[model samples]
Target: MTPRRVTVVGAGVIGLSVAHELARAGDRVTVVADRTAADSVSAVAAAVWFPYRAGASPSMPRWLARSLIRFAELAEDPGTGVDLREGTVVERAPGADRSWTAAVPAAREALPAELPPGALSGVRATVPVITGSQYLPWLAARCAALGVGFSPRTVPAVDELAGSADLVVVAAGLRSGELLDDDSLFPVRGQVVRVANPGITDWLTDDEHPEGLTYVVARRADVVCGGVAEVGSWELAVDPAVEASILARTAALVPALAGQPVLSRAVGLRPGRESIRLEHVPGDAVPVIACYGHGGAGVTLSWGCAEAVADLAGAGLAGAG
Candidate 1:
């Protein structure tokens, strides 16, 4: 196949992953973004492998399964910042959708004693936890080594790259809709606190927490405590009350977080939509592929979506021939 010039918009996990795959498939890929990985919303993610707020879709199972396999392989590389960790998901309701367990065979019903106070049941599983502080840089470095070029700039429209590239990938996350002139996209605001990890290695999540979404993800350097999933919220500033509530709830769940010194606070606007957008849109000066609206599952679904994007791009290349 003849190599095609591809311009990928956005440098978050989705875009970077897409670039890596496309470049590996012999496409000359250039990544254009307004923010680097460290500044992108992906940086604020608690980054555990589980899907959150991504909604139920038939494709989710395949995407999740593919991502798990890739992450498990990446975990072997210490620089990748991906780790296989044992964790628990506390449920407040009985017979909750354990369908996600299909992707993680190790997942099993938690024992009665394993349920935290006020929890009806739980699931224990071994999953990948990514430390974005380290993982993003590692991903970018890998992409760079693959000869993917980086352009630090904002693209106002997908057509802007028509003259320079044969294809444009709109993986711009929350701002993607604006570039495509589509309004179906919105943000699900998430707030999180990064604190010193006090030797705790396991992770826990209680999405049904009465106070709101609460999760504690421990990494090599720090533990990521989060968060609130406020739909339709665009606020980016850190809310003092929200931070306090997150610390209190997470500490109550693990106890070890009671007095940990806070290292930082972050807020990310997760790109939310009724469903994820990962299809090719023709009729543009340059053929455009839409690949955003992943919501909070951007990282969880990244590899699977990237592989799919590369397939779409390759199909387009073949058609042009």
Candidate 2:
């Protein structure tokens, strides 16, 4: 098979995963982005593998299943910063959807004793918890080893790369809609506080909390506690009030967080849309594939989406030939 020159626009987990897969499939890939992986929204992710904020779609199940298998495989390599940790999702309501359990291994209903106060039900499972500080760089290094190239430029439109490459992939996160001329995309702002790890390894998420979306993810170096999901919010400024609330909620959930030293604070605007955009656009100067709008599940759905993107690009290249 002849190598196609594919230009991917985005450097976040989604784009990097797509680039890695395409390069592995013998495509000559170049990634263009305004922000490096270290500065992208993906870097701010607590990055647990559970699906969050991804709207209902039939395809979501398959994407999640594929990603679960891939992340589990990656966990075998310690250098990848992916670890399978036992965790629980507490639900204040009894009818919360447990459909996500289908993709999770060893998933089971938590016992009454396992449920936190005021929680009606819970699910315990082992899922991949990624430390983005370590994992993002690992992903980029893997891409580089696969011969994928990188360009630190912001593409205003997909047509801008038409003359340079045979194909283009739009995985530009929140800015993806700008180039695609789709106005349905918006931001779901999230804020997280990183604190010194007190040797706690278990992870917990209480999205149904009356206060806000709260979670505690203990990674190798630091414990990530957060957060708030403000839909349609574009603000990136860190609110001291939000940080204080996060600390209070997290410490209540896991007492070990009490008095933990502050490591850092971060804010990320999750690319929120009605559903994930993973389709080929026909009316472009070059064949363009759109793959963004993952919301908070970008890391959770990345591998599956990337594999699908590579297959789509391959089919397009074959059709062109």
Candidate 3:
């Protein structure tokens, strides 16, 4: 098929991945965002692919599975920077409702006698951990090689993009409201702290964290410790109190990380909705499709979503013809 001119809003990992998929579909692609690809939330994330951590809602598990498989395929590309990793998600202990890992227990494994008294209570399933610092820019380069154009601009209004492209996709994440009137969408603020890990390379338990402690693996630099899931909180400034709490909790979870050099702290606002939105923006001109409000599963769901968008758009175009 001859390439169709297409414009994508937001150059974060999600937008970049969508552009890459579209370009491969032979569509001329343009990506626009407020910051460079490296400065987006995707870059800050541990970049692992675990969609179920957010729960199985919105068919997210299946979507994540598709994205993970697609990511693996892309990783096979000689130059693509995506990395596929095998990891574990330990359920140190189960709760009354078993809200944590009930949906995904790898199976009951005998707690290692070597495991400190609290090393872990039970075993949950394991999944992969992805590092996005390398992955996001790699996707950007992939899109470029496939004839996708990059734009360093923000769309302050839907009309700005809706009027300019043959087709547009809103992937602005939490900032989508600037151009999209999605009342159901808002920010779920998350804060992560990176610590230097000299020899630590495996997934370590984040301890008995009840509310916020989770493990994140980053790129060449080090691992990430977090974090808080502040709902509707969009403050980007690092909260000193929250930062201290995260560090303390992470150390407790993985004592090996105790006393490690502290690298930096980051804050991000995940786009969240009643349901992860993946439908056409009804009133936007030029047949706009939405793929935002992924909450924390944005990276995990990327490829699956790109495939869906490309498929739906391709189908829509064919139906119109």
Off by over 4 Å in 3: 52-58, 74-82, 92-126, 204-208, 216-219
Error in Å for residue 183 of model 2 = 0.6
Q: By TM-score, how accurate is candidate 1?
A: 0.98
- Alpha-carbon TM-score of each model against the true structure: 0.98, 0.98, 0.86
**What is the C-alpha local distance difference test score of candidate 1?**
0.92
* lDDT tens readout by residue for model 1, 168-203: 999999999888888999899999999999998889
Error of 1 at 263 (Å): 0.8
Q: Which residue segments of model 2 deviate by more than 4 Å?
A: none
When sorted by TM-score, best at the front, the candidate numbers are 2, 1, 3
Instruction: For residues 153-233, write the lDDT of model 2, one tens digit per residue.
Output: 889788989998999999999999899898988999999999999998999999988888999999998999999999999
2 or 3: which has the higher TM-score?
A: 2
Top-scoring candidate (lDDT): 2
Least lDDT summed over 10 consecutive residues: which range in candidate 3? 96-105
lDDT of each: 0.92, 0.93, 0.70
Tens-digit lDDT track for model 3 on 119-225? 45444344445666666667777788998998887677766765567788888877776677768777778888888875555554443456465664644467788
